[model samples]
Target: MNEKVSSSIPEAEAVIDTTPDNGQEGRIIMPEAERARISKESKKEEAWYSGEPFSSWEEVEVAVNEGLLVPVADSDHYKVSANAVEGGRYLTPVAKKMLDLVAGEWSKKMKKKGEDIDSLFLIVTSMTRIVSYQDGLSKKGFPTADSSNPRKSTHLRGGTFDLAFKWLKENRSVAYKILLEVLRDLHKKEQINLIEETTIGVLHVCVNPDKAKRRSSSRRLAGTGSAKR
Candidate 1:
């Protein structure tokens, strides 16, 4: 994977690229204030990898407090514009990266299909979860296949997230094909383990935490190298 040049915020985020341009080496020139801001916000709270799943949200909180959980975001790829089933957007950093790339490809595909792409976005139904949240959903008779065991759940590991496919099917069928195409690409790359949950009408995307770790590590190394001028 190509290394990243910088960090994030939202649509205004900038990523550096050191490739030569017009016979000159590429340079990154962020305003001093912006650079400082990026440095401050980009400081990772912790370096975390998925491990034993927790039996409850309480346990999840313990790990979070210990700097063992990396927060995800509602970035450009899988946006939480509406129809959100969860409160926050949090995934393992690797999973987030995978989502951004694959989802961007999906958007392109939608445009090729002659679909209106100006304001299209996916509805995120679920992201990182705790055992208590799973239980609550189960009690409400939500259609998830046995999330009682943390180890067995990709959600707990921050390896899995869900897209509200049913919402698209009912409200935006034109984009459905694009979503599938993106999923196919992701699966082929071995970057995700996906399941089209017919019962719940959602698409689950699971990241291999180990793979994500390697990918994120490489990005950091590339960033550090590029920052050397």
Candidate 2:
């Protein structure tokens, strides 16, 4: 690890670690102090774009199925219940279907390692739209809001949601890794142009499954990139 040896506990700026990508450096950097400041401001920024206060977050366990978790169509109230997405807006019909595909794909993989694939949740780690509207898009446990959208706030339009594993033992579910591979594979076969996402190895992936993959194999065949967004 290329330790920069900052004099003190510098601020939390965007860091460019030269490790994960085979010694390749990160594309961004932030001073330690700037990081803390941004983090403080991130409280209200919205989860999808930037800040997410972990302290204020509450983690709860929920179930996942091999189908869409939220509802589609328009309604005065959220199509999905507050339980599914968690403390945010409701899940779009598209988002629900995506959640199911991920949960199922991950579960099947995790089961091999004795992981509780079913004990997953539609985490709302940031970008809290509203209570009743939340379909489990948590406003918790994110570093800082730095996207065009930001975290802890609503309006994370497009079919996106934060997902993660809860009671796993010994090792993190390899299912997460599998999920990425499947996604890349789908990108090849289906040409599903899933863009502007963090390849940050999240325990869960927030994506639009309908156009992305199917629930059956979680290995939705990748299409061509001809439909690049």
Candidate 3:
């Protein structure tokens, strides 16, 4: 197949081999082993900072602090905001740690993709924060659409941040692999959950509290949606 750009040959190439197989007379087959190796190596060599062997967000922060990580926003970009996305506001000490880690991962990932890491924007949601269950709702089933409560409010009671994936897609394809990679990473940590609302296009992640409290009397009545609930 043709390459996506005029760069290196993509591993998905179907090269025509003319080497005659001594055992098969006139029959010839492509080097399947070599092809498979290329495919495997490409994944190991994928261009994303987080995919790097030893990279982390701390390293990326050095670059950010040195007046880097500031690139122009695309016309379609809508991630910039006053609170979380712009000034990095309302972040607790613990939330900052997770933000650092997340930023480092994004930095390395962008480096791998041969993309500029400086240009990405952050939102308050990027910081992991506490999500408040509705005053009376639980996880088993959320309040019906007709219920008095339409949306459960989230706050940074201690630590947790929601990340805006929609912001990343402003100028890029919504299906960009990097965004999905970050999402899966957070999900694995069990520190984050994808929001149920399609319109939000964000990830909800929070730091695990050292000493968390649970209100069972109110929690069990409603199915617990959060890990602590």
Candidate 4:
């Protein structure tokens, strides 16, 4: 009998030290003030890209079908969780492009380190979410932002994603460091906004809309097509 492939990836045992002081050197920490500022800025950008918040899963599907939101699947550098796909596996074009750029840079860095890039991939734990799902999570004490307030969560706008850090730290320690380096570089360039959600053990990332627009325009002017889903 043939074995069926599991939809979910199994998390590796916690081999790496989880202590706060262990491997703390050169770690990127986003200050609370910076996170607050970025949160506001990201909300504005999200509003610009996704007009009204998705109130239901049907609305999310409609947006996907209409191309307002693009589906993100497993790729060479990243893997979307089964739960993320089932909840809402979509993002704005600019956000998706940003994700690709981050993952691509991390892959390059991993290759330079002589690591097996194929074995290292970022695990996306969450993506765009409908209001109902968000509410459900909130009720379950999942630390979800307020779903009633459209400006509260970028995930509602399909412009944010959560990367599972605990799994990466325990399983792919080197890749996790490289990933942080890539994120730090991008954040310095003001190309993205990041929030380290310690309570959730995930890094929440939001792409900067202005930078994405500028890059898209530059590409067009250079006769290069815009990034596709």
Candidate 5:
């Protein structure tokens, strides 16, 4: 584990208001074609991880206990928002690894640039959510993918999380740019899917679960072969 960074960044400087407001006045609506593509790909990922969405907090707890889901806490590379994600900060083991990889890469890049890595960290505004919580967001008229079908939500699958951009840009402009660069590199590598939700002012990220599964299988096979020696 890396050295934990101090959470001294002012709340006002790190928090973003994600609450719904008036109609989509200045919000950037995703194109219908692009939206459909993201949904289709995300649905495939959901199926790969869990066949169904977590229906309640109890389900989440069961997944955690079964080692299917892991708790995501504030780390040196990132901070979990206290207000935005009310459901719970949890993610699949593979998703947590992906998040840490991205954050670690960002830290290395910042260090190479002679930047103060201690003062720079990504802010995760959202994580896993129960079906009921998804329903509440839908009732509030928030833009959610397949709100009517909670199982289609990637967040419920526990492989998706939102990174705050508005607050980062407003407070730490330089760190914001570097973080984008890191995400772009990872996106190009097909290690993750990145969705810039301008409407909500956050970057929605979904880790590639299929690839992780393949890697896990490969490791298991190798271990078994070595054991047979």
Candidate 6:
């Protein structure tokens, strides 16, 4: 530990002694302001560029096989055709909302910029996965799969999903800018966790399940009340 003498303790005798007999209780005494600053620095939030970390990949696979994960295609927020990509198509409700919010915001921003937006389609790069499937992908040296653990991936639990930048770009340079803006907005609101794999050109995001469920319930109640009126 680099001990810098604080301005509050000018005298050499007042310096925090590094005597071995003092034990763990021998901590430096500083002004209340300095103490608060140290406390704040220690409790700072983690950088927003990484998704939720998981342990015990086996448990995640169990959740997937038990049919606990919900399908994203069932949600109204996203558009899926009969030719949707195989696998990774399913996601938890919360993840679905995160995708929807981003897509919706992206569309709105494009429209505001006076760009034609009708031809664009939001692509779902990866979704729910099983342990075996993830393992196979990892063995093939897939970039996204390499970052995910077969047993611990949020994909297995339908809690996470990925979107490729190419699909969003669709030949438009501003697509990624819109994506970043949407991510910033959602993350600020604590609605989703996001990580941009710049090398792979993919955006990996996960929504908070608790927040999604509560919002869904509130929407339902509001709809019912409106109907009664």
> By lDDT, who's the top model here?
5
In the predicted model 5, the residue pairs found to clash are none
Error of 4 at 66 (Å): 1.9
**Model 4 lDDT tens row, 1-229:** 1122122344421221112332545233434555454445444334333344578888878777766678899898788765464848888777888889888998898878876754556778788887677666555334433324433566777777878777666556787888899898877776676766654567878776666764322221112322221
- Expressed as tens digits, the lDDT of each residue in 32-70 for candidate 1 is 454343224222211222345556656555545554445
User: What's the true lDDT of residue 77 in model 6?
Assistant: 23
**Model 3 misplaced stretches (Cα beyond 4 Å):** 1-80, 83-88, 125-156, 174-176, 210-229
Each model's lDDT = 0.51, 0.32, 0.35, 0.63, 0.68, 0.48
RMSD per candidate (Å) reads 19.1, 15.0, 19.9, 9.5, 7.1, 19.5
Tens digit of per-residue lDDT, candidate 6, span 1-229: 1122122212211221212132434332334454344233222112211233323345444444554444566322234433333555665555655777778888788678766555444455567666577665545433332233334444545666666564344345575677778887876666665665543345667555544543223221112211100
Distance (Å) between predicted and true CA of 125, model 3?
A: 4.8
lDDT of 6 at 218: 24
lDDT (0-100) at residue 194 of candidate 6? 66
In terms of lDDT, which candidate is stronger, 2 or 3? 3
Clashes of 3: 28
Of 3 and 4, the candidate ranking higher by TM-score: 4
Model 3 residue 72 lDDT score: 20
Model 2 TM-score? 0.36
Instruction: Give lDDT for model 1.
Output: 0.51
Q: Write the per-residue lDDT of candidate 5 for residues 134-219, one digit (tens) a residue.
A: 88766654556663565567787687888888866765666678889988887777667777776566888877655555332322
**Quick one: ranking by lDDT, best first?**
5, 4, 1, 6, 3, 2
lDDT of 2 by residue, 20-62 (tens): 3433242333345654554454332222222222222121111
- List the candidate 4 regions with Cα displacement exceeding 4 Å: 1-8, 12-50, 85-87, 144-151, 214-229
At residue 145, give the lDDT of candidate 3.
Answer: 19
TM-score of each: 0.60, 0.36, 0.41, 0.71, 0.76, 0.55
How many clashes does each candidate structure show, in the order listed?
Answer: 1, 63, 28, 0, 0, 3
Runs with alpha carbons beyond 4 Å of true place in candidate 1: 1-50, 55-68, 81-88, 145-151, 211-229
